[model samples]
Target: MVVKPDWLRVKAPQWERVGNVKDILRDLGLNTVCEEASCPNIGECFNAGTATFLIMGPACTRACPYCDIDFEKKPQALDPTEPSRLAEAVRRMKLNHVVITSVNRDDLADGGASQFVRCIEETRAVSPHTTIEVLIPDLCGNWEALEIILRSQPEVLNHNTETVPRLYRRTRPQGNYDRTLELLKRCREFAPWVYTKSGIMAGLGETDAEIRQVMQDLRGVDCDILTIGQYLQPSQKHLQVNDFVTPEQFAAWQAFGEEIGFLQVVSSPLTRSSYHAEQVRELMKLYPRQRV
Candidate 1:
């Protein structure tokens, strides 16, 4: 493996703040994708008193090669208490914007969509002023399950495409490229009032033309927000990085996305699906057209 570029280096997290956030999550028995997935931006995001809550698991149903979240064939049963615990964390953290995501629970009947709805409702009951964003799975392409979560009325609904189509089989073996887009398309149709978001990781052996095509494809579905970032191999066992995308290239894509009519695009080496996600609230502020 090559040494990570200087641009990828992150300053160590301030321990005091990191501990505070961790204490809350631990005390509440809540999990965060930040720690579970080994996200590089954990330091900065957590210190700022925000987190993308990883509900429904520390385990997933699919073993995507590019992901660090653990995969389980027969995951444990859902915890009814999780929603209230997550709500308490949001209240204690005093967050105005919260991101809640979960692992694919294909083992369940509703694909765990009910848990998302419960979390949304619980958070609102406790902190009505706070905005909610849900990063969800494809639900094995179950549109009905998707609708269940959508009806909860989250401010932003996100589902990551993760990688370009051609890489789906090898990188995301259990994932279908078209199924992902179709989910986003249906989300737009189901809740046009909600801001729709998707994410893609570069350095996975995809070409510029392919990336641009993805940006175009996302716009074709009326996707409101896009996030592009470099893919760092989690361990020697995981897929190796193909290339390190340069800052200039990320800047170029950011501009290109705007040209294609994406309401907001966050592209950078360190950017993750929910990295600096609280700032998504600014989209409506900066671009009135995004007020949908």
Candidate 2:
């Protein structure tokens, strides 16, 4: 077993605020990636009243070995009331920004893209001021499905590459590196106004050169935001941690990303895709892009 480094330790968060956020999610019966994915920063994010809403699931269709979200259970039918309920959570929490992501719903023809659109529309209806970001799956290379979600124009569109191409067979067997890049490229082309983002996980036995190549690939697609974080093993059955990337290394990646033209780069041991994602609101102000 690999011992976790001191730099990876998370500060204890205020329980009162965390509990309040949990209560709302429970009351609304909404799923958050924070809980489902066993995110290291759950307490901090919940305490801050922010969550990446996991729509159309708590059950994923694909069983990615590194992920903690459930795949054994059968995926349930999409709930018609989910969008309004999620919007209600946004209204009650008074969040300045919200991230709506989902488990892979490959069983559906559109890979749950319609559900994402509904969530966006409902969120807009209830919390018009809350900027929205959608962290989506690749949709099995279904460009039409991609178009459905792009048309809604979430302030940011994020799809994680997860790891380098060489490790895709081992880490993300069902995912394709080319397909992932195409999705980001298509999102940029289809919705130029919507900021495109991608994330990469470190400590996956990937060399520094491999990580930089992935970052370069993302930049080639004009991805506006990039997040790089250390990957921790979710369980004994999951992939073992290859290494614990240090803060200094993360700083280097962030610097390189900025030098290469990423509008914003968040890299650290604990940086998850939606970790501190609300900062994009400020980025929007600094590098304002026209909303089509």
* RMSD values, in order shown: 1.7, 0.6
Record all residue pairs in model 1 with backbone atoms less than 3 Å apart, i.e. clashing. Answer: none
| Poorest stretch of ten by lDDT in candidate 2 | 1-10
**Tens-digit lDDT track for model 1 on 1-292?**
4899999999998989999999999999999999999999999998898899998898899888888899954688999999999999999999989999999888888899999999999999999989899999999988999999888889899999988899999998999989999999999998887889999999999999999999999999999999999999998889999999999999999999999899889999999999888887787567543222
Tens digit of lDDT per residue, candidate 2, span 103-201? Answer: 999999999999999999999998899999999999999999999998988999999999999999999989999999999999988889999999999
Determine which window of 10 residues in candidate 1 has minimal summed lDDT. Answer: 283-292
Off by over 4 Å in 1: 286-292
lDDT at position 273, candidate 2? 97
Highest-scoring model, lDDT: 2
